[model samples]
Target: MANKPSPSPTWDEYVSELGRNLQRARISSGLSQEQVAYRSHLSRYTYQKLESGIARPGAPANPTLRTLVTVARILAVEVSQILPAAAPDLPEP
Candidate 1:
């Protein structure tokens, strides 16, 4: 049988988790959102949305890799540190 794709969290779940991770990292680093935003060269509103996982109209923030990288650098963490762990390749039968 062909290999099936791995199960993963829903988009909302993933985005929410990412936001939580970012928030935790920021707090642990003793940096406020505004400070991180300034250091990352991103608008405060954009960084808020990213950390909250909600865009205008109640949609997920869905930040780009570049944004994540920039924020990670400002927070002094590797990108993987903010990413969710890999899901299992397949669900059990």
Candidate 2:
């Protein structure tokens, strides 16, 4: 028997979802990207890019985990809620 591959989301869908998550957090906290950037020690442009889904790899490119933690703190939410979960690999039969 052969294992079937699961369909993954399209690139655009992935980008849009990430962007939506960022915007939702920002809006829920009544904060602008600029405010989050300042508090997180990230540039406004970088934060904006993240919110716009212009940042490549469909995720924020913050080098350090501390940077994401800072942003999560500013949003008053768990980092896991914002970051994408890892997809399980297809089984090899």
Candidate 3:
């Protein structure tokens, strides 16, 4: 029999966990969302959206690498620390 492919993860799940990671990192760094946004050169509103893991009212977030890098830098965390473990559906390089 041909091998079956597994269901891919909903990116929302990964994004939600990433948001939690960012929140925890920010809390640990003792910075408010506004502070991190300012330091990262992002608008407070944008940062809030990032932290909520939502791009819009009902859409899942898909942040830029630049945004992730700056936020991680401000939080004193490696980007890996904030990223979820898997992207099984992602295309192999």
Candidate 4:
């Protein structure tokens, strides 16, 4: 039999978790979306979309790695802190 791919969360789920993590980190850092966005050299709307995980028509935004790095720097957090943790692998018997 062919090897099967591991199951993972849907794209929407990953986006939502990333957004939530960014929001929490921003809140903890006592910064508003506008403040962070400006500092990160991004538009407020873009940052808002990233943090809300809704770009258009209820779809998730596709954020770039550069954007994430910028946001993390502005928020004084590591990039890893803004990303969601991966699910642990299952153990074999």
Candidate 5:
């Protein structure tokens, strides 16, 4: 039998991508996790959780717009760089 193609990425996948971008940016800047968190005005533990790809245990990391912009500023990366190219579909508010 032929293998089936995977379905579209879920919200969790998007969150994972964001985490990856954050890690890459931090590495490129030669900044420690603690440094990034502190500069971003986030707690080290909370930053660790985001870098680990979860907002909480068994949950996706859906950061608020303020948080995203703040982290991007600290990392010197564009917000678009930290966001997945494609995101899960959501109804218009």
Candidate 6:
């Protein structure tokens, strides 16, 4: 038997958590992944990957402003609610 390859490491935990939050919000808003994808101008595969936590949310594929706005519009909630809060402090450049 051959050893299976490991899955890609998620870029960030915050993105993974955000994916969960988005899914919950979507369900609460009574919309399917496909519906959100279509309305958000994203492919179903992209949306599925996002909801499944396979893709990192708020990253390149996941952090599209269009997606956040679409989700907010569909869920009737503020974007901040679904997305993780920003760090309160940042190191100076």
Estimate the TM-score of every prediction: 0.81, 0.66, 0.84, 0.81, 0.84, 0.67
Compose the digit string of candidate 6's lDDT tens values, residues 11-70.
465566777888999899899989988888878898877776666444433467877877
The sequence of per-residue lDDT tens digits that candidate 4 reaches over residues 21-73 is 99999999999999998999989998988988878877877799999998999
Q: On a 0 to 100 scale, what is the lDDT of residue 60 in model 4?
A: 76
Candidate 5's residue-wise lDDT over 27-88, tens digit each?
99899999988988889989988887898888988788998899889888899988878766
Candidate lDDT scores, in order, read 0.86, 0.71, 0.88, 0.86, 0.85, 0.73
Candidate 6 Cα deviation (angstroms), residue 89 = 10
Clashing pairs in 5: none
Which of the numbered candidates is closest to the native, going by highest lDDT? Answer: 3
Lowest-sum lDDT 10-residue window in model 2: 83-92
TM-score of candidate 2 to 2 decimals: 0.66
Clashing pairs in 4: none
Predicted candidate 2 versus true structure: per-residue lDDT over 20-92, tens digit per residue:
7878999999998889999988899888876776666545333346766777889999877776553323346
Q: After best superposition, candidate 2 residue 69: deviation in angstroms?
A: 2.0
Candidate 4 residues lying further than 4 Å off, grouped into runs, are 1-7, 87-93
Clashes of each: 0, 0, 0, 0, 0, 0
Candidate 1 vs candidate 3, lDDT winner: 3
Considering summed lDDT, which 10 consecutive residues are worst modelled in model 3? 84-93
Q: Higher TM-score: candidate 1 or 5?
A: 5
- Alpha-carbon runs more than 4 Å astray in model 2: 1-6, 10-12, 56-64, 85-93
Can you tell me which runs of candidate 6 are displaced by over 4 Å? 1-11, 56-61, 86-93
Per-residue lDDT of model 3, residues 4-77, tens digit only: 86576677877888889999999999999999999999899989988899989889889999999989999999
